[model samples]
Target: MLYLFQQILNGLHMSALYALLAFGYALTNGVVRRTNLAYGALFAFSGQTMILVAVFGWHVLWLTLPATVALGILAAFAYAALVGAILARSVFARLAIRTPNAIVVATHGVALMLMEIGRIASETRDFWLPPLLAWPVVFASQGDFRATLTVMQLINVGAILLVLISATIALERSRFGQRWRAVCDDPKAAAMCGVDVPAVFRHAVLAGGLAAALAGILTALHFGNVSFGTGLVFGLKILFVTAVGGYDSPPRAAAGAAIFGMAETLWSGYFPIEWRDAAVFLGLVALLVLRPGHEETRVAQP
Candidate 1:
């Protein structure tokens, strides 16, 4: 029972990390039809950037979290603008003539370029990230029933929950959220109704990027390690969460993340950690088979 409880707590922490990544990816997919594979690069960039900042001095470590998030938002905005502009000038301008496959290939090429850039940026740096907090919270009636959580883990979980709740409420009740919904429903029609489709896309990308950045930083903080390849693992996990939960709803994605997190943690604790990914993959397959077309409709906007 104690072991089970510990596993649950660990799962909660993992779920929070997955939720952050899934939310960002879902938002981008919901708003724009394009999948920004370059997003994984942004996650790597945030971790590497935080580590670099910390190396300068321990005093600067305090700023790593916020600075990483800011950089993520800025990078996302810049990347979105550049990608959107390029597509507008090149591929999108030829939409009438270009095949869907061609556009996908082009975007994939862009993703590869960004990935290579991230790899180059952190090639020489150490992959370890210093711990953001020293103490862990302990709760136990007896030594055998003990459960421990680090300060950073608690902060990460809190941050993710806060973002998820705030985003859902804002999307359903806020004015900007209404415009976001309008653009998501139909960009051309929204434009006809005077919605700024381009601006909305930029905002979505920026928000998503910031969320991804925060997730990456928090993960590194919790685990005390990060590397260029870290983004690949995280991005794939996020994709799984999004697919399993139905990419159209933020809450659903978060729920899916929580489920996956619990499954992975428990499986890792009882079995081999190597089996964790396989367990998640199997769960995803089972969910898909069981919930056919569950995500057919987008969540209604407030």
Candidate 2:
């Protein structure tokens, strides 16, 4: 019983992480109204940039917490922005209106290109952040055992929640939110109503790219590292998770992602760890086949 509660507590962090990344997916899909395959690669690019920054010892040269974090942010977001901008101008701009399949294929190519670039740039080296806040904070103790989480984990959870809240509020009150909702609902209608549909999509793609970068840096900070190869796999996980909750609604996507994170954690805790991913993914696949929010999640016609 104690262990189960501990597991739940542990799952909270992972659940928040899922919400963060899925938020990025929701942002992109909300505006483009189509699946953009480049997102996972953008995440990997951010992670790889962080690895390179650490490799270069820039963090040590900065000599301050804010400066160090700023360096990391610069590296992560710069690469993400550059690649995202390229995708927006070169690929999505030219292909999205005419050949959606081409957009998919082209984005896949871009993803592969980013992965290869990351692999080559890092020289296939592995780097992780030094254990910054490794102290465990005990929340509950059962006799001789204490359920604990690191201070960094708590901080990460808090930071992620703050970001989620701020973004949610901005979405409700900001012009981008209104335009995003309009475009997602009906692109032609939005264009007819004087919304620059293309611009909205580009902005959404950029915003989503940055969101993925933020998630990458945060996850790297928490876990100390990221796999360059996780781009597509992570993106797909976000996709399945959001699909369950309705990708058309960012709130729903976040909720669904949080649920998946909890379920995944619990499954690993109580069942065969090796089968955890298989079981979760298969379950999601079954749910996806059902696709509960089909009408809400349908892609808007270009």
Candidate 3:
């Protein structure tokens, strides 16, 4: 029973992390109409950065929270402006004029380039980030049936909740949010009404990048380690959550993240860790098979 409880808590923590990444990915995809395979690289980059910073004996490790998020936002903005622009000018523009396959190939090519770059930069270092907090909360009591919660985990949950709430409020009440909604609703109409569609997209990409970077930092703090390939699985998981959750809704993405997190956690605990990928993939397959064409619904305004 205690083992079960521990597993459950672990699952919740994992789910929250995945939800954060999913939310970021969904936000960008919702606005840009393009999927970012490089999204996960932000996590890997932030984690690696955090680890390196910590190793330098800098007191700034304590400031990783905000710094990591800022890094994420900056990286996202740069990647979107640079890579996204190149795609827009070279491949996407050609595709718009000729064949849609150009867009697909271009985006995939960008993803490949990003992955290779990350691999080369990260190498095979098993980097570690010092824990953000000490002490773990015990949530259950039984013969070895204990569930422990870390301060970092709690912070992660709080951070995600805050992001979701803030995003919701901004979208519902702010002018920029309104403009974003308008752009999403009808880009042509929004542009006609003087909304800057490109600016809106840039902001969206920035938000997504920041979110991914934050998630990576938090994940590093939580797990105490980072690797170049870490973002690969994370990217896939975000894609899964976005697909399962209504891709347009942040709340739904969170929900899907929780579900996926819990499933992966529990399965990993009970079965071989190697099966984690297979389990997650199976779950995604089940969801898709059960709800074919569900994502076709129009995105709801905040």
Candidate 4:
């Protein structure tokens, strides 16, 4: 029973992570109709930038928890926006009129470049955050077993879910959301109707960048640090995870990613941890192959 309860807590953390990740990816891809694989690298890079800032005396400004969190969020978003802008200009620019596939292929190179930049910027130093909010909070207790989770876990999960919900609302009801969907359905038509296609693209990337930044920040805060080399693997995992959920809708994709996260956490809990990644990857691959979703089912126009 205790194990069951603990697994639920563990799954909650992972579910939040994957949900935010999927929403971030879908935010851009669903609207832009182009996959920016550099997104994962941007995510890692943003977190690295925040850590580098802290290591360089920014931590001195941590006068209070709210202050620290606000500064951290600002740092994350700043770096993400910087990277996103660069990618938008260099790799993602003019794709609608030029060649869409070129941009998709270019994102691979951009991802590698960002990873190298992150590695070089780190200077081979570890940027582990001093543990924050480490106190455990108990939920329920048995005679000898207690269901507990860390304060960081609760904060991370709550904050991520909140962002996800807020983004969903924005996408569904806001003017930008209306424009985003308009662009998604038909960019040429959207443009003809006064939707600034370029601006829409930029906004989508920035929105996605913010989402990725938040995810990276939370993961780093919870796990101590994220490796500079983790961007590719993280990107691939998120790519497949979001694929499982389909890219047509942000909310549905988030739900799918959440389900994958919970399943992964449970598998890790009951099985050999060493094989968990392999098993999860293989399972996701098998599912993707057997049932191709929106991206796969779409008939490309020539």
Candidate 5:
């Protein structure tokens, strides 16, 4: 029972991160109808930059605790937003409409370039960060064991909930939501009706990128280290989540992520950890083979 409770808590935190990351992918795909593979790169970039800022504060800037933490967070968000905007405008916006294969190749190139940059910057090594909030809260009790929630995990849940709920409400009630629906349903008609199709697409990518960045930072903090290879793993997991969730709905993405996190966590706990990812990949492949056209039928709407 204690093990079950602990796994459930862990699953919830992991699920939140996966949901946010997958939602970012879904957001971009909704607008341009193309997957921005570079999203994982952006996720890694934000996390790496956050770590770099902290390192600079400690070694180079000689800053106090508060200053270091603030600077690191600010740097993370600023870099994520700026790079997201620039990439959306320069790369995704221009190529997403031109050729399907072109955008895929271009985004993959962008992802590789970012990964290489991370490698060089970190001197071909992994980067670690001290947890911003390491305190844990007791949640459950059993014979000689207690379940606790770390501050970071609680923050992860809060952040995901706040962002997802606010975004959903805003998309449902605001003028921007109407514009987004207009574009998603039919870009040509939306443009004819005075909707800025390109601008909508750009916004979608930027929004998705920022969400991915936040997820990356939280995930790195949870794991206590950030690696260059983590981005690709995140991208692949979120890809599976988006596919299973049905790209048309963010809520469905969250649901899929919850299932994924629970299954992955339970599997790792019960089996050899080395085979965890292989199991997930095989499961994803099986799911794809079983339901090849599930996503095609569920149309996107406001």
Candidate 6:
């Protein structure tokens, strides 16, 4: 019973990370009608940037937790925005002259380039953040039954979920969301109706950037280690989440993420931990076999 409860707590924490990042990818895919593979790169970049900031803070500035964390968040956000702008201008905007497949391949190339850049920046060294909390905090207890999680983990999970939910509500109920929906339905028609099609695309990327930034920072803070390779693993996992959930619905995508996260946590807990990635891969294959189709057709029309 205790073990079962522990697994549930673990699953929720992992699910929060997956759901937030998947939400960002779903937003971009819904708008452009194409999977932005470079998003994975953006995720890695933000986390790596945070680690770099931490290293500098520790070695040079002698800053404490509050200062270092703030600096990391700021740097991650800035870097994500810059990367999003570049992707919008260089890859997405230019798709007018090429086939959609071209952009798909281009996005993969962009992801590789970003990973290479991260490798170079870090000089092939593993980067880490100072531990956010020294010990786990128990949330529930009853003589011999207890549930515990790190304070940092709890904070990161709660804060990211809150932000994602708030953003979703605002997007669904506000004027900006109305315009975004207009653009997504038919960019040409939206433009004809006085909607700024290109601007909406840019905003979508920027919003995705912010989501990626928050996910990156929170994940790194929770784990205390932000390896350059994490982005690839996370990227693949989220791709599966987006594919399974359907890009048109952020809420559904988040739901898919939770399922994946729980499955993974349970598998790792009961079996060989090293085989968890393979399990995820197998799960993705099975999901695709059961429901295979083009992602663009699934976007919700408003």
Best by TM-score: 5
Residue-pair clashes per prediction, in order, are: 0, 0, 1, 0, 0, 0
Global local distance difference test of model 4: 0.79
lDDT of 1 at 11: 86
Ten residues in sequence with the least summed lDDT for candidate 4: 293-302
Instruction: Give per-residue CA lDDT, model 1, range 1-302, as digits (tens).
Output: 77788888888898788877877878766764545555665676565555545543334445565565455345444544555455444543343134433544565565566566656765755656545674878855466567888787888899889989999899899987888878667667777888777667667766777777777677667776567666766776777678788766767787888788877888988998887888778778787788756543322111
Q: Lowest-scoring 10 consecutive residues by lDDT in candidate 5?
A: 293-302
Q: Is candidate 2 or 5 superior in TM-score? A: 5
lDDT of 2 by residue, 97-213 (tens): 677667677878888888888888877876777776879999889898888888988998898899889888988999989988998888888889999887887887788788888
Instruction: Give the Cα lDDT of each candidate.
Output: 0.67, 0.80, 0.68, 0.79, 0.78, 0.80
Off by over 4 Å in 3: 57-104, 143-145, 292-302
Better of 2 and 3 by TM-score: 2
The model with the greater lDDT, 1 or 4, is 4
Task: Please write out the lDDT profile of model 3 over residues 1-302, one tens digit for every residue.
Answer: 77888888888778878887887777766755545566776666666555555554345445455575455445434544564445444544445335543444565566566656655755755755545684788887777556788877888878877887787787679887888767666667887888877667667666776777677667777787767677777777787778889667766787888888898888888999997898789879788789857643232111
| Candidate 1 collision pairs | none
lDDT of 5 by residue, 1-302 (tens): 88888888887888788888877777777776666688888888778877777778977899986687668778888988887787777776666555555777888888898788778878897767666688988898887798888998898899898998888887789888788777777777888888888778778778888898888778766775677767888887888778877777666776787789888988877889999999998998788789847543222211
- Quality of model 5 by C-alpha lDDT: 0.78
Model 5, residue 254: C-alpha shift (Å): 2.3
Q: State each model's C-alpha RMSD to the native.
A: 4.7, 2.2, 4.6, 2.8, 2.6, 2.6
Better-scoring candidate (TM-score), 5 or 6: 5
Query: Of models 4 and 5, which has the larger TM-score?
Result: 5
RMSD of 4: 2.8
TM-score of each: 0.81, 0.92, 0.80, 0.91, 0.93, 0.92
